[model samples]
Target: MTFHVELDEPRCVASGQCAVVAPDVFDQRDDDGVAVILDESPADDLLDDVREAVAICPAAALRLVEG
Candidate 1:
């Protein structure tokens, strides 16, 4: 199964947890620190880290969508 990541920018609080948990998949904006999706469709091996990032997002702005 493959998963795609989505970010709700308005809901993000710039906690930086997602980037910390999955640097290859998520990052923060240099200015406002908003979450950024580096790889929308992450590799299967990164599922765990992506899942962890989605779960720990302080603002609940991250989601995984099966495609």
Candidate 2:
């Protein structure tokens, strides 16, 4: 299965939790500290971290869609 990450900036609170959970897949913008997707479709090895980041997002801004 392949997974894709999505972010809703308007709902984001710039918490940086996603970045902390998966540094390689996510980062915060220097200007707003909002989460930025570094890798929308990450490798299988990174799926766990991506799911964790999505689950822990306080604003529910992150989602993992499997295809």
Candidate 3:
């Protein structure tokens, strides 16, 4: 299984929740502070943190599509 992680930059509030929850998968851009996808398809072990990041995103800017 693979997960597709996407970030809606316009909706991001730069809260950095995703980064905190899953640093290996999510990060903030140096200039805008918007959330960026470091790893679109992370390993299974990181799935939990990725899901938590998606859930805890304050602006609902993060999404997870599993396939």
Candidate 4:
């Protein structure tokens, strides 16, 4: 299965919690401090952290797309 993640800018608050949980899969733009999905399909072991990031998103901007 392939997993995907995305951040809707209007809902994003630039908390950077996703990066804290899974740096390899998430990053923030230096110019605007916006969340970016670096890698949607991270390793299975990192799935937990990705899910945690989704759960912890303050603005509820994070979304998961399953394939």
Q: What is the C-alpha lDDT of each candidate?
A: 0.96, 0.95, 0.92, 0.86
User: Residue 31 lDDT in model 4?
Assistant: 90
- lDDT minimum window of 10 residues, candidate 4: 39-48
Better of 1 and 3 by TM-score: 1
Deviating ranges (above 4 Å) for candidate 2: none
- The Cα error of candidate 1 at residue 44, in Å, is 0.3
Q: How many clashes (backbone N, Cα, C below 3 Å) per candidate?
A: 0, 0, 0, 0
List the candidates' TM-scores in order.
Answer: 0.96, 0.97, 0.93, 0.85
Give candidate 4's error at residue 19 in angstroms: 0.7
Over 4 Å off in model 4, which ranges?
none
For candidate 3, write residues 1-67 as lDDT tens digits. 7888888889999999999999999989889888889999899899999999999999999999998
The TM-score between candidate 4 and the true structure equals 0.85
| Per-residue error (Å), model 4, residue 38 | 0.5
Give candidate 2's TM-score.
0.97
- Residue 57, candidate 1: alpha-carbon lDDT: 97
The TM-score measured for candidate 3 stands at 0.93
Leading candidate by TM-score: 2
Off by over 4 Å in 1: none
**Error of model 3, residue 14, in angstroms:** 0.3
